[model samples]
Target: MGKRGGSSTKGWAQEPIGALRVGTVGPIADFDPDSTPGFDGDRRLGEELLTERGEVLAGLQELLFANGRAGDHRSVLLVLQGMDTAGKGGIVRHVGGLLDPQGLSVKGFGKPSPEELSHDFLWRIRKALPPAGRIGIFDRSHYEDVLPVRVHSLVPQSEWEARYDIINRFEHELVDTGTTIVKCALVVSKDEQKTRLAERLDRPDKYWKYNPGDLDERAYWDDYREAYQAIFDRCDSDASPWYMIPANRKWFSRLAICELLIDALSGLDLHWPAAEFDVDAEKKRLAALPD
Candidate 1:
């Protein structure tokens, strides 16, 4: 919703310029996966910009962590959802790597365990939430209940259908309790996915990243697309809107996500907590101590 650009000469902008909030843009199908929406730079420039912003990102994260330690009740949750090979891991590594690990919580949700399935969908999600002043990341999240389950017919129609409202309410509750949610759907082109998948198979080093079952899921690509569209339609709200990230270019996606994190952290307007002890008294006490 703001101006699209690489970076500001001053500092990180309060609103990310790279990607638009879901509703402000047209249907997901119309957007180009390869296009860099708000960026005018090439890959080299994107990389440099990301490097430049890393310092700011780290400082902001420290402010957040400090506030939490000082008893602030605010935090941020970044939810990343996308097709296989859409670069979720890359975002976590490149962007998440920039911040202090102590201030960040990353959780990847695979197929639910039996124990997880026994509880309400949000139960596990609730447990994984970032504590006050930390950033929590969901590699895949509650939307999985609605997306994969709906696409594969893993649950009854009515049961999965109801989760849309359930998720909306859950997010609303999170916001009311001082959590800022940043939900990003990383969209990659099918052709690019095929290329990436093939590369994984061709490289012995990357074999561990591949699964035969990924091919099975690829057959249902269209169905999954429909499911994701439903998610954007239903769960997107003012309190926690979705950001559709075009992830065909891994470098661009990584940079855009970094910008989004900057926007989220800077928007909080956090300040360094004041020292509880009297500074002058503490200084005098330190001065009086034998070196």
Candidate 2:
């Protein structure tokens, strides 16, 4: 799991991915969703995953720095899409703390602005796209156009269904550029969400995190589940696959996010660029002149 889960010496990849099942919580799985390193009630290598994640994150920093200096066009689009109380902001904050802010940008989307609604769904999203040699993160994204828009009948069923193909082609185009997309759906159980909401109510500082209408939305959890299943089924691809991150454990979710990012970043040919001028020789000449 070192530097992006690039090498799984512990055979983590050989084990199944558990904790969150596809078609129920997050994405479309080719094999059984019940399989993973944490399956059968065994949670081995949790700390090890954290260790690997940290290493990978360090490597990403190094790689990003090198890319910036080398002027290589590389981009990472981290789309964190999830329901309320899923720790999307928390995860983004934790991971973002690790990176150089000059090269990073994070945008959280809410109800459309008058300007945002002026264009189609992807139009507002396109404005936030990370340029080359930088990382851009979206806390909530265009996927909302599919989720809530379809969930509450904000749009026609036919209209929302048509977005699958549109979104796929859009992502395809993103890959056609140099952008690598990390699509993570953070998930917390209903009970956990309720507990978090209670904690928020009790703590004055945490009050900002809660929304009263969330109670109403919580009733439609089953509908959102179906919506996610459909989205995962239609959109998971080699160009941009989905990661069903378990948000029940914040540490693990952050670790997995870093692991996946590291995995993808390590794939590029990242090398320290050759010195433009002979700095060593220049230093020697200056020293000699001073003497």
Candidate 3:
């Protein structure tokens, strides 16, 4: 919607040059998974920045929550889509961990259960939406319908192919009804994924985190890549744009996500809700009470 480059906006963080933002159609291969846009600092600097921004984000989130409770009736939705072990969990813990749990809703979409599969693809997503005045995080979101469903041919070509329009319309409806959607694709290189997966087996403490099935899916990396390319092509929009974040560096990935969210929430123009009750009268009443 705005200029496609590395520059600061009045209320939002500056996107770095080469950051892949889907608007019309473009090749995903142009974006390097190792590139850290807008952040040229090392991991140590990334950590410091994340900490500083985390505090600011917490305050903004509080304002958003207060405004919602005071009947503003708007919310923020962070839709995270990525291949397995792409640092989605780390982003959730590091960035989302800053917010008050009362105003946070985190949902992970895995393989649809029998009950979920029976309904429309977006049924669970719609149900899991963050209420007005809160932030919602989707560990993996409705995009799965387009990605794996197409990659694995779980649905007919005609069916999954048509989902792009469905998703676009669905996001537009959400925007109309007062939800701001920020979708991020954590881009981790295949080599990095292999390293992480191997470390999982090498360390006993990380055994539970290791999934044998992930290896099976690794075989379909190219398929998943193509699937993601299609998603960026079809679903990226001004209302709900997709951001491809280079996640090979976990610290940088976390910082970028926080920056994205901070930028989104900052644009909400949130304010602390005014007190509905008479402050002076309440103060007088309390002062007159016996201690």
Candidate 4:
């Protein structure tokens, strides 16, 4: 695809996660929902750009998969957290669809089941981790424990507050075991969210996706904002830093996430594995087989 306004590949890969990260200081209030951050392209062109980059994206995923198949025990986990209608599903459908399905795992976490609630919050998360040879995407993740739980008072403040340290340690353990975690928060403005929710209500095809409770949650927008600030303050870390993606524009959001994934994979030395057996001998053996 033709270049957009974003940083160069060389620069992006080397840039610290803090460049687009939110931590300690809460920038949500002052941050622009429509900010494109190194990208100036509009939705119309951004869609075409994503199409253009598809091949390269697939190729990079293949290299990562090949590395895993060749016995490299590393894998990638993309954790997507955002407000409702912020396009988590779109990321899975667009950006994630570029990868080989055989090597892709997507887990959508909803309300905890009775069984899930019985264990630690991370219990279900651990079960959803991708194997060494695949890419895993979480539609919503463990951060839900901190966000909605904290906002709705599902857990006491002391307990949810304590989860920050527990979560950091859990992520550290995951990294120590060869998982690279990429966390993204798709940020949309209150107005933008209202527009999206309205669209869902107005369209017959989208009616099934609408939930009355979304309105209830919207009432607590400020509360959730504060909860998110808390998450950024305590959870953003070197091992798994969070990228705040301005998602007012769906096309740009998808493109930005695609570029982010490409950059993350580029850091790894990925290559096609050399054949273990003699290629000529293997070819001859196959050639001699009966049709």
Error of 2 at 143 (Å): 0.4
Count of clashing residue pairs in every prediction? 0, 6, 0, 0
- Candidates by lDDT, descending order: 1, 3, 4, 2
* Residue 282 lDDT, candidate 4, scale 0-100: 94
RMSD of each: 3.4, 3.9, 4.0, 3.6
Per-residue alpha-carbon lDDT of candidate 2 for residues 1-291, written as tens digits (9 for 90 to 100): 223336344534432222232433434323222233232222446555656556566667567666766776778888898778878988778777667787787888898999888889999899889867777889989899888888899889989999999999999988887788878887677777888889999999999988899888998888887787777888877678776776666766666676667656766656666788899998988989955
Worst 10 residues of 3 by lDDT: 1-10
Best by lDDT: 1
Model 1 poorest ten-residue lDDT run: 1-10
Runs off by more than 4 Å, candidate 3? 1-20, 23-26
Query: If both were scored by lDDT, which would come out higher, candidate 1 or candidate 4?
Result: 1
Off by over 4 Å in 4: 1-19, 23-26, 287-291
lDDT of 1 by residue, 245-285 (tens): 89999888887788888778777888889998899999999
In candidate 2, which residue pairs get closer than 3 Å at backbone N, Cα or C atoms, i.e. clash? 3-56, 4-262, 4-263, 16-35, 16-36, 17-36
lDDT of 1: 0.86
Q: What value of lDDT does candidate 3 attain over all alpha carbons?
A: 0.83
Encode model 3's per-residue lDDT on 20-78: one tens digit a residue: 46542145666567877655577787788778878878888888888888999999999
Each prediction's whole-model lDDT (CA): 0.86, 0.72, 0.83, 0.81
